[model samples]
Target: MLFSLIAFLGLIAGLLYLATGARPLKWWRPDTLVAHDLRTLPYMLSYPFEAPDSRQNIIFDSASAAASSPSSTTPAPATQNSAGAAAAAAGGVATPPNTPPSASRAGSHAQLVSTPSSASIGTELPGIRAASLDKLVQRLTHHSISDANFAANFLMTYRAFSTPAELLEKLIHRYHVPLTPSSGRGAATYDKDFVHPIQVRVCNVVKLWVKTGYRDFVNNPTLIARLKYFVALMRRTGHEALADAVIKSFDKQAAKFAADEAAAARLAAGQVVSPASGPSSPASSQPGTPRPGTPVAGLPASAPSTPAHGSLATAVAASPAAPTSATSSPAILKTPVSRAMNAHIPSRSPSKEEIIASPIPMMPPSDLVADITSFLNKKQGSATDRMSRYTAMLCSDSLDALEIARQITLVDYELFRAVEPVECLEQAWSKKDKLTRAPNVLAFIKRFNDLSLLVVSCIVLTPDIKARALVLRKFMLIAQALRELQNFNSLVSIVAAMNSSPIHRLRKTMELVPEKVRQQFKAIEDLVGASSNYKQYRTRLHNLDPPCIPYIGVYLSDLTFIEDGNSSKVEGLTNFDKYRRVASVVREIMQYQDTRYNLVAIPAVIKLFSPDVSDELGINEDKAYENSLLCEPRAAS
Candidate 1:
């Protein structure tokens, strides 16, 4: 037993010796040498002493070793003879005369990292025993790679790998794989020789993702983002389609996310889960439709027909009977992922039209309120700016009308900033003939007009643009808002139309208030409504003529005459008698170029009556017709 104990102790000691470098058993250590080398083996090995961090200590070792032993490797000592030669020959390295050469820099480190070249196989390791290979390996750095994987792999590589070509050539031999040489152009192709086996593996990955889980994906954008970079790599270095495949794989992932969410949501909602609809409906079949025999869920295209309508659902419903021939298990399914994943997936969200019609923050307080007012009040001297003032007054909230207002002012300020209205020519061009740019100009005008109406009614109502223009910028709110009193239906419409009409804002202002208001107080409701309607009456309206009310005029604002309801005036109201008289004068003196479009009375008559065409007209037609004729454009009082 004592002898056996000694023998056991001896074996243990031997194993311990093997474990640690009990003796310097190896001729050369690849790893230690590699480490020692990188520390000093950088490319610019021998730089000037003045150079920062010069590797002189590592580089001059060769010369020192030579001095120590005159019989050192290079007996001729030619390498040491050339001192400054390193700058030109070694690309700017300068070894001192007494320092040791870098062992690692001499290519030993590289061999340690990778396989030794064919030239090294016959060469002996400095002192390693072939019998000790196993023991040395135990002490040497254990391969990070598992013995089970790629342990025997013969790497294909070159000592001085200058370009991708050399790398490819080596890889072909090492992997025993064939590859087609690229043409001079270097564009990648999918020829038999060129297709990377790894790429095939990537394709296989894609196939696996699709075969088992196609419908589970909803938003594939993430997947797209991921595979996209790889695919791009392929495009630049490999085949376009392979890159495309990577991109498509991403698309699939994104789609999967979306589908999963949608399906989960439906499942949660107790609704039916179905295969993805095609592109048109997201539920519609996809374009480049797969043939009837195309495989899905690992079922061969020729497999027994499962009804197309519900095959996937049926298979998923029965997890047990589902085929298991796929390369991998279904990716870990989560409860439906967050909605964010559907961002790239098209079908999961609401349609644009639906979104538009839905209530939204489409309206906001008008920021132009003060701006337009300032522009309006700044008017030096011009009636032509009336439209500018008008639009500014009307639509502080409306982008379209304000835009129109902006254009008119911009044109005016740019061309005739200091010029008065009359200085500019009238009836400047042919009717129905727009200047080359006028159509675009007019279209913008129309857009602003349209936007104005919608914006105002938006009930995100702000004060009128004209009032803002006048108040904020000293711009005239052109004219006051068209009254809602009499013919409110056309009031707003008229304002918009007048701006767009051939009549300049200043010229148009003259026609806005009928004489019935200027000389006398009359309810404006009798003739015009809103400025918008006023415009409509001029352009689109018909069958609307002066009513047979004997009232003198229509007063749109305050300070008009009270109706016959009482002898005394009521608070918040006025009378129309004075307008009746002005209506007579206006009827006799003025005539609109287009008589069909003119209002019966002047703007002055607007202050008296409200527009509802109230029962203020006395129960006497003769009196009413007389006044009506007085207000009429073609008739005399």
Candidate 2:
């Protein structure tokens, strides 16, 4: 009787395990249930034993902390696609209380579902499936960035390290707290200093996975889903630059994979897989036959032995047949047919590496000077003609005007890159360091002053009220576009012109300005205003996509503040921190320096508005007074 009782108890335990429908235990049995049923079975088995406080089942106790942070809490509803019962049993994880069910669960499952649920357990056991990769990603929302970083690094050694879907989702879906450092003397000044380290580390890891695990990521449904999620998140969060990089990397990998497969298929089919070559030169003819350039034995003495460099081959290539426009050298004309053939063979587009490696072509000081001279010399057109052309360029699309502004900024960047912080103290240009930075710095000042003059001229010279209003509207548009382009220097210059005493004193003229235009101008003024160290502008720039041009003055101010606040040397030892701090600011400018701006030159537009006069101050108080007097009706004599 005792032996029978023990055997019956063991049989009962086996029945309970089978009822749970665990996948590992059921491997040898013929599977009768679908995946959905299998997932549901475990929940059914646990239902009787589940306690009332099921919310405690989550892998992490984030719910309570999430509830406390009212400002940052935005819990996503639990997804129906989660492993259901098995997931719930794995951890006490439940969807947050009071959240609505996901819209996706609104079909047949909607009828079956009775209660609202919280988010599913993002954590999964190692070696389970792609779901296991999410274990590290789920940690990103942890209170400590270091903890998240540690989890990410430790997970790299796991057999199921990272899935593209899991990585991408983490990048886009994870909770993030904005970095808002205080401006106190003892506190860090930069938002980056306080940013979650997980953001940086995870980015590096994703890039690595994409590079090394290309096959796993390419054409995978899971990765595609992640890519879509990433795009949506970028739009919502305004962190578009990060999303742009990920998408670009994905495209590159896909294209390379396609190319490799095509090559492999050709090779298997016994077709030539070598890169296509251009037509062979005439000189490559068979040795026995009269080679190209070798006179045939039967030819007359007058007949040429070889094709002349400027013969049909060359003339055909120089289609216009104009020597003045074309190069005359024999070397240039050599193998014209081959050169022409190769020209038609379109070259592959430059890869991202090549683009980043290539430097921005520098414009010489002489060329810029010439452009300025031409702008000043040609004052022949009526004010209307000049203003109309300038306004058209300002409103032009595809960032042509903004590109010119950035080119000017590039000049400043190059000249100041090597400038020492100490040189800023020298009022007089006596030191070599000061001289090195002076030209570009001085040119920048001149350029700024010149823009102000142009602004004043536009406002003062337009005699008609309606035309002046139109001119102001264009200037307003230009300012708005500059803000969008992140060209702070030009943005401030435009705003300064509008606020110039001369322009501001036009009380009647200001009234003529449309209310919409005036309101827009005020908004721009507020953005560039010196409140909170230009916090509004900085926030806007952080969200903007690159190939952006920054306002250099802000960076210069940072350098000044750093120098003034900290001593360069402490106790006769070199203060590396001060140097490092200054270098960081400089590096920020450099990152934005050489980005290629896709802009087409509108010479007519550029030449018309190019900086002409380099005078220090163009807002002549007296000239402003004269304009004010002119605008006001004369007192009755």
Candidate 3:
């Protein structure tokens, strides 16, 4: 019985050692071990597995303590997790969350005990931890539905964060990581099903990178060579279709790059460059002659090839030769009608003689104001009459707010889309010389300011309180319509105008506004309110799909913040972080620029909102306040 008990105890001990992977007692081990035995033995001692939540709390507490300490008052650097630290040691930045350890090192001997489940990978994306470069790349190649969108954004903005060489290196390293189990001890082994998917995804990511950001490769020969190397590997591995796609994209982008360079050269040489037909033919480049298709100043590209109605030249020629006055120089027209007509002219580069000629007589400010007012009245009659005409022209049912909103959207869209990417570079729109430096951006901003002023003027200039209240209500409905149409630019302008001092001070008029309208206006105010740095507006903007006209001021402010917050370079290398932030914002702007509103343009409405007409109608804040006082004078103290 004693012998049987001893044998049973030995059997139990052996089973326990096998089940738990426990080491034998020190006394049981041989004094000298073979090479195979040493290789099989784990190098590091294993510890009890701790829950991720417990580990996370510990890290957070340490970080919080460090942050709150008075002795270390300066802002702490980005906290690097263990995996990130490991990656940093290997000549890279932090490893992104959910990335495998094998890819983090080039020839690392460290082993992964277990692979994370597929479901757990990429589930924590877009979080702070995932902002790391490696995380971004991992997410870009992820199989999640949102990965495509994330990839596009990263592609658009990656230049700010990383260079082509660094990114390509990471991508190649990730692709070459061993997916199959290794015969060597302690080597990682992923599921066979998961392995194929990851490899395929890496290839897909490369294809997408080529398709979306081909410009990077076009501008850099080194990148193209590296890409070819990757492609050669892909071909060797039997990924012929994917390899073919990559090669084809490279060829296509290379051709496009060559064509673009040629076109730019032609443009620099004072030759016409057609968008559709490439560089203009030699026959079209007659010296000193502008191309017929060339866009005229202050006119949209879609404007009629013929001269505008009542063009300055026609008006000047048709006017009965007015008797010359000592006060009126030949260059200066006397009649307000003629002056207003001449103001609509498309300005062009002045000829040598015109530039050197005697200056035109300047109109006194009072006379200028009088002329503008008279011109506006003659063109559209009184404010009330103009409102009626606009309402009639824009709305089929006279008060069809949706149609009014659509018309405003169409006009705003035209101005918004006309702004070029170059106009916003370096905060050109905000500079003192913005008129020349950023003509398109300045024009867009000017329209916004004018629209805001116009809204305030319409309310305060109304003689009757009831009519003013009705106008206010109409604007409120238009704001709501703008919101629905995703025309946040115009929506904010109208909202701001309604909340301006002149309009807001009208207690009686505001009292007449319906509760529904007031509530709607309140909601709009909440949406666009400056509180919390316009967080609500930004959130709404993010949730919106394409074909949106985002408030330009928000993006401009973002660019400004990026420019002010970060240095342009670090250690003589370009500061890609700043570039990344700027590119992210600019990418959004470019995306919106490409998406157009579906609403049809109305010629009458378009003319009404034209820059010239808008300037004439856009009263100054002081004038608006004066009108407000006239409509409803303050009670004597």
Number of the top-ranking candidate, with lDDT as the measure: 3
Clashes of 2: 7
Per-residue alpha-carbon lDDT of candidate 3 for residues 88-144, written as tens digits (9 for 90 to 100): 222112211221222222211122110122222333222211134554454454432
Residue 582, model 1, lDDT: 22
- All candidates: TM-score: 0.16, 0.38, 0.47
Candidate 2 on 90-122: residue-level lDDT in tens? Answer: 212222122222124211011011011222123
Q: TM-score: which candidate is best? A: 3
Error of 2 at 310 (Å): 34
After superposition on all C-alphas, the RMSD of every candidate to the true structure, in Å, is 34.5, 25.9, 24.3
Query: Which window of ten consecutive residues has the lowest lDDT sum in model 1?
Result: 148-157
Order of candidate numbers by lDDT, starting with the best: 3, 2, 1
State model 1's lDDT.
0.24
